[model samples]
Target: MTALRIALLGAESTGKSTLAQALHETLPVLTGLRVARVDEYLREWCDREGRTPRADEQRAIVEEQERRADALAVGHDVLIADTTGLMPALYSEYLFADTSLAAPAHHAHRRYHLSLLMATDLPWVADGMRDGPHAQAPVDRLLRRWLREGGHAFVVVQGQGPQRLEQALNAITPLLKDRAAALPPTSPSTVGKPASGGLFSRLLDRQARLPGSTRWTCELCDDPACEHALKSALPPATPRVP
Candidate 1:
């Protein structure tokens, strides 16, 4: 089976770490896949650097995590990564400020097959190192932007810890199962399609079924204008007589 990479991403104090740990404990029982957290790798890097890491350090941290995850993914069928405090908001902030900070090497949008975004509904509990005030609004905005940018994700809200864990498992299980099943079987004989039809035929068939072409029409509406007309234009109003 091909490796499954799942990334847990969201703002701080949103329980990303807790959820990652919960999933790590639960998923093995449900799916029999080994899970790894990116935090473990980050801590190791911090120790080696012998200093608190800045945002720039996250780039190297995430890259290392990606490399480690990719290598381990081959051994285990699935790997879940707990990502850093890098979200779309941080990316936009850098962009707006015109700062020189480059995006993290292993961006969640590109690296993970699935990303779980924890919501900010729960009260923020700051551990000693995380002393900043609750940043719910900013985090929420960032999460919305992240989803809009076209990543597969789910927003886990505040609830019973066990219930949240169950919900997360349910949401991810089908995706994992479907992807695992879709992987092409490893057999030389099945490498290519049958010789009865060539690749051109498949391409032509796809072209014939394309929407907005003469070969295919709107499935919902019978009139072409119904599909193409501007929503702002209402039917012509009768002229008022004077």
Candidate 2:
């Protein structure tokens, strides 16, 4: 079966790496299935070269990130991308005033079954690779704008640590269930099991659905004002398995 693709997107120090690593580790335990992760290629490039990529070097970074993700997707039940080519593409635009990477980056992003946008609610820390806290807001605005313009659906991941992982799992579990339902059971033993893929079936069966009215749509979700208003009106999300 084709792996479910999960793309994690966020500005610098917004916890993309932390959340991605959590999902990569937790998902396999929650679902008795294989999980693979493709880390941010740009991070490695920076560490190796001791500097960030130049405008001329952005395209290679985007291509390499996509290539690694594609390579990892085979034979895995899930693929979690720490970040996607959207980063380099957006950075290209934000830093170099170049818009050329947008189309290919969006094309790559569309393949993911789910996208999680890490909220900037966490405190930012200085890192050698980071552009600093000052860059987060503008970069975030650009990312939201990109998603809106592309008409892609993405859930915003909020909260801290385990709470954040739980939020992402809540968004992801439905897709897991849908995929399970679509496939035919190949064994009698597997026939009556919960669609959760394995162990945490009981917990997943009771996972809370996102509270929303019929009026909710991807377009509105990308809008910060609309999302905030809706989330503010809803009750707190149910806590996931501890």
Candidate 3:
């Protein structure tokens, strides 16, 4: 099975991360496919350091997000990314007045099957790193424009808590059902940035695995990876090696 890479996107104070977590937890149960999650690295990096990122650091932040998501995609049947490379790109454009990050960010987005934009409807919460509610609307508008102008089809997520989660699930179900047809063919238009024979490529293989074909296993459970699980509908993997 080809892993469906789903990115939760939006401005700060939105429920992007929360929805990512909720979807990560619930998606596997519904899809019967193992899910791997790429968490937002910016927040973790910010909390570790003492401040928010400057213009130059934006590139690194975006790269790290792609790195995390790519690594998770190696083994899981579905990749749930809290945010995409778009965040850093937006930050550079908004705060630092730089658009250089956009190209790399768009390329990073091409790897995913879908990006869901989280709505800024919920009450804003201060996590120490957030730039406050003032930045929300503008940032949301900017992100929407970025996604639209980039020729990317993105779904907008609304509501609160469980309702929001249900909305995301509803959006994803059809994608999963038609994932094989939805996935891009192995060509330049759909090729991921990772190199051939790299750790990531060696594990996941590509979309449309035939019966008796080898499939990637849970990397954490075994060594040297790429263990086949015969032919199951989903990428054949368990939480642990059997």
Candidate 4:
């Protein structure tokens, strides 16, 4: 079976590392399934190289970040990525005004079963590779804009410490259930398609079928607000009697 991949995204000092570590330790006990965590490769790269990467080197960083996460997803029931390829792509855009990575990053991002966007509610702390607290809001805006343009849905994780961890767990628990019960089995023909159920099922149903296409494409659709509209129109589910 294909691993259920979860992506954690946010600006600097948003508790991504902390929350990822917590999930890595807690998920297996909660779900009784093998779990794997992919740490941000950029962090390790910075530590080893003693500096941040330049514009020319950004693609390599993003590639490695995604390569490691995809490798870990094999054989594991769940895979929590501390960060995704979108980070370096965003950094390249924010720091160097490079927009070339957007398409490839979005392609990589769609592989995730779910994306949890860490809120910028917590205070920022300086680290060796961190740019500054001042860069957080702009980076956050850029990240959201990119996700929207790419038509990807994400949950915003709020609070601090245990409260933050609790919020993340709450968002993921339902996904774990849906993934097990509703997702289509992975195969050579169906590989790279987003998992189906609920919102995803609606989205896929609306997409125009393309010949020999392995992934969903928006070639026939022009409405950017379609996702939001569909989400709002979905009726709340009624509880089942015991």
Per-residue C-alpha lDDT of model 4 across residues 40-89, encoded as one tens digit per residue: 98889899999999899999999999999989998777899999999999
Report how far off residue 152 is in candidate 2 (Å): 1.2
TM-score of each: 0.60, 0.84, 0.73, 0.75
Better of 2 and 4 by TM-score: 2
Name the lDDT of candidate 1. Answer: 0.49
Q: Which ten contiguous residues of candidate 2 have the minimum total lDDT?
A: 233-242
Q: How accurate is candidate 4 locally (lDDT)?
A: 0.72
The alpha-carbon RMSD values of the candidates against the true structure, listed in the order shown, are 14.5, 5.0, 15.2, 11.4
State which candidate, 2 or 3, has the greater TM-score. 2
Q: After superposition, how far is residue 210 of candidate 4 from its true place, in Å?
A: 43
lDDT of 3 by residue, 126-236 (tens): 987889999987887787777767777565556658656755665565566565235445633225433434322321332223245222233421211122232122233
Quick one: RMSD of model 4?
Answer: 11.4
Tens digits of lDDT, candidate 1, 1-242: 54676667666576767887887776655443445555546546656777546655555555565666667666565677776324422543532542332244324445566666554535777654442544555555655454544443443333446544544564465565565345454423124534445323332343345344221122322121342342222111111111
For candidate 1, the per-residue lDDT at 73 reads: 69
User: Which segments of candidate 1 are over 4 A away from where they belong?
Assistant: 40-52, 84-108, 150-152, 179-242
Each model's total of backbone clashes: 0, 0, 0, 0
lDDT of the candidates, in the order given: 0.49, 0.77, 0.68, 0.72
Q: Which pairs of residues have clashing backbones in candidate 2?
A: none
